[model samples]
Each structure stands twice: as structure tokens, then as C-alpha cells.
Target: MAAHTAIARPPLVPEIPLHLATEITPIWQATEAWLGEQGIEPPFWAFAWPGSQALARWVLDEPGLVAGKRVLDFAAGGGLAAIAAARAGAAMAEAAEIDPLAHAATRLNARLNGVTVVEAPGDVVGSPCRWDTILAGDVCYEAPMTNHILPWLRRLAAEGAAVILADPGRAYLPGAGLREVARYAVPVTRELEDREERVVTLFRVLP
Candidate 1:
């Protein structure tokens, strides 16, 4: 890994530890430059983002929410939520990421945490619901990404899947058609989010 290694305990989700970058900016820049050289997207897998941390924490705490259910961690960077679901007694915990490097990172992190999460192929938008639960974290950071994913997620929710989104006050988050289930104050590296603490909200997509 290009990042300086450290045992990171994310805010609001301390039980699920992660091998995260000790210094955010250097590794972030290094990974970005390296990916650019290879003509790849940003290496978001190098860190345990705050929203993912909160979702993992919430799932671990409320094991009944996912116990014996099939779970899908969408855009699962580092597979934190997927690992938590597996550990929380989900029948199957799968992570789907478009970036190969991020997918590999998810597998590595899952192993470190003593769990197994299958990797799904290709972009999952428009795919029929194959799991009982869907978890999306910090996915609304960009308008294009949110626009592309929100409608599909809404459709899944309408189909009776438990679709949950963890957002850190993104500009594009929907104002309606969702209900807040929980919230957490997640501590994060300022270099990554320009703030030390982020208040993330976990919402259940309503049909």
C-alpha cells in the first residue's frame, strides 16, 4: 500500500478496526498520482471513510437488522460494512466495486477482519435485487454519481429491499422519500474531508 500504515479506530465505529493511512494527504496524493499514471480513478480504498465507518457500526450494533439476511455493500471501499455484516451473522455478505484496486482492498480488509465477502462483477445499477439488504455509504459526494445511483436505489426500496444510505451531508442527498434511522459523529482526517468531525446520517429509503 502506498499509504503509511496504522491501526485506525474510526469514530462511532471503534469495534471494527481498519488498516488505514496514518497521514491522509501524502498517501492520498501518492495514490491519486499513481492511479493517474495508470489512467485509473481516485484510489478511495486507501482510507476508511467516515460514512462507511458509521454504517458498519450501526449494522454491528443492530445485528438483528442483518442477521440471517443477504447483504450487499455497494461501492464497498475496504469492505468495512460487508465485513461487519458477515460478522453480524448475515447469510451472505457481498461487496461490489467497479475499481479493481478497491475490490482487492476490500478482500484484503475482509481477511484481516476474519470474514468473507464475495465480489460482484460490473456496475450493479439496474440489476434486479438479489439480496435482502443494500448498504450504500458516502455515495452522494458527486452529482453525477448520486444521480446515477439514487433512482436505482429507490427502485430497489420500492421492490421491498431494505436499502440504506449513509451520507455525510452531501449536497445532492434527497430531502424526501427517506427517513432517518440513526446519526453519528464520525471523526475523520481533515486533509480528506476538510473537517475533523463529520456528522453522518443513516437513512432508510422509503417506498
Candidate 2:
């Protein structure tokens, strides 16, 4: 994991250090070669996406929101938001990821930032809500993935968990039941996204 990445801070959340790839193509190729398959999911864990960057910034700036609360960073790429939540005094911070490499990256990054983030590896979609607050960043990009997680997320929201989602205008984001709470213009590289920056919106998922 350390071989392909460098310890760098994300543009929006500079306080936390992450092991991130400098370019997309090389990392993608490397991931494919390492995994021995071309059909695997993109190495989303290697880059700090716009949504997670915004979430981390918001959590750090407004620590009171997560202070003493049980927080979860769902689909946590590099566990950026989880690190921020821990730094902001969350009672417990957890990061959930299906990808093994993402889990490793999260563990590595958490250690780099000197924070303890419990790893919730494998599929946690149908699990009972163990969190007081949940941060899902850039999760609604693909239709199938959006469909798979939305119902469970809505259920979590209905069960009184404050499920917060940060979106950078992904096509699969639902049209309703989101109350906007914050917005950020996150800087991004054109290699990953079409635009050089993305306006990420944070929403409270309403049940």
C-alpha cells in the first residue's frame, strides 16, 4: 500500500494526512495488476474525492456536530472524514468499506493522522444503526450502488440516526428527502473529474 502512494494532505482538509496517489491512471493500472483483474472497481480509495473533502472540512470547522457522538464514515475512501471526526472529539469513529485495499488505506491513514478509527470491513449495508451520525461521501455516483444503499440509508435515517450525505452532483442522487445543510467548492484534479473543482453539497437524509 505504501509503495504506490505518498503521504499528502487533501486540498480542502489540510490538517489530516493521507496516503494518496499522485495520478489516476498509474494507480488504476497498478491496482488492476495487483488484483489480477480488469473488471474490479476503480481504486476510489487512492484519491480524496470532492464529497469526502467537503465532509472533512465541515466536520473540522464545526466540531460540535460530532463531539461525543458515535460517528460512522460510510463508504469511507481513505477514511478522511472518520479521521476528522475523531480529531473533532467524536466519542467513537468508525469507517466502513467493502474493498480490502480501502480498509488497509483507511487503517494506514488513520494511523498517519494519529487517530483511532474502528474498521467495519465487508458489507455493512443491512446492519443495525450503531452510529449517532453517519457521513457518506460521493456514494451516489452509480445507479446500482445508489439503489443498493439508499433503502438501508433511509432506514437508518428513519431509525433516528443522523445520516448525512455529501454529493458533488452525482447523477444517481435522489431528488427528494435531502435537506441541504452546507456546500463547499472542493478543488479536484481533472484526471479524476471532468472539472477542476466540484461544488459539493452536504444534506441531512430525511426519512
Candidate 3:
């Protein structure tokens, strides 16, 4: 078995405009069979989820809202939301993922979109630095993860930061206090899971 190494946080990169190629780009992610083919790894963050792609497409449908805001894309697999926020004119865009491979993928996707994305991880949570806006997608499918992240999000929102989540009615999404901002019917492939279709809804955390 390959031993895991200590997690090292990477530096933040600059911001850039949205790319035209994102629309045509095929979002290929690892499925259960695919992971088995490649020899499944312990860390789950190496692969991007279908819900994340759904959130990304939903973000693309909106413009002008994120301009000039400090944005944090939490659990940013493939940095889809980070790239979208940057394209939408976020002043500083950071992609936070705990997995090293996902961090690398975030950087690669940032470059592919001609954007500079900062890579941060879960360890950065509760740090002195605060973002004007925080975005999370497909993060609440698991009860433990949702329980862990919900308090952090609430704390951030309580501190007056704008927090948003794009979820496909995942089992763990809190039933209260999220205002619907937008919705999208995302075309999903079976590359990530059994679900071939999903309706993603964006919500704004109210103060």
C-alpha cells in the first residue's frame, strides 16, 4: 500500500475572465468502474462529482453577481465553480479541496480556462482571512461531511460573508434558511455515478 504524505497547502493564483471553451468542454470524471480500472485510491477528492458539474453549469447561466467579490469555492473538484467565479469577475478566487490530486486538477482547469485559481484546503477554514462570498456544490451528500461543513458555513455567514450552495436536493442539505437564487437542469453523464440527470438549485444564505 502507498503511504499518504502530509497535506501541503498551495499558494493562491491570480484571477481571470471566463473562457468560451468551457461550454464545449466535456466534463470527464472518474466513475466507480473507472476508479476500479485505475486502481481505486483511498482519498475520494481525486475525482469530481456530477453535482459539481451541475453547479458549474448553473453558475455559467448567471453573470454580473460575483464581480469584484472575494470568492471561495469550497470542495472545488476540477475548480469548476472557482473558474466560473473568476470569469464572473470575482476579485480574488480560491479553490479549496482537501485532496492533492484535486488541487492539481484545479490548477490545470484554471490554466485551461486562462484563469489563475488559488488552492486552499479544509485546514484553511476558520482562518483569520474571510471571503466576501463562499460557494459550495455537491458537498452534502454525506451526513458527516455536511455536519462538519455546515457549522463553518454558518459561522462565515454569521460573520456577514455571503455563502451560497448549489445542491441537487441532496439528503443532507439543511431544510431551512436558503433562498433560491437560480436553478438548472444539468445533463449529466454516467462517468461519476449512477445518476444520469439532475436538477441543481442555487441558494443564497440570508443574513
Q: Quick one: best TM-score, which candidate?
A: 2
lDDT of 2: 0.94
Reference-based lDDT, residue 128, model 2: 96
TM-score of each: 0.92, 0.98, 0.74
Q: Candidate 1 or 2, higher lDDT?
A: 2
TM-score pick, better of 1 and 2: 2
Rate residue 62 of model 1 by lDDT.
Answer: 97
TM for candidate 3 is 0.74
lDDT (C-alpha) at residue 167 in model 1: 95
Residue 159, model 2, lDDT: 98
Question: What's the CA error at residue 74 for candidate 2, in Å?
Answer: 0.4
Which pairs clash inside model 3?
A: 18-87
- Alpha-carbon lDDT, every model: 0.85, 0.94, 0.65
| Tens-digit lDDT track of model 2 for 88-121 | 9999999999999999999999888889999999
Better of 1 and 3 by TM-score: 1
Q: Which number leads on lDDT?
A: 2
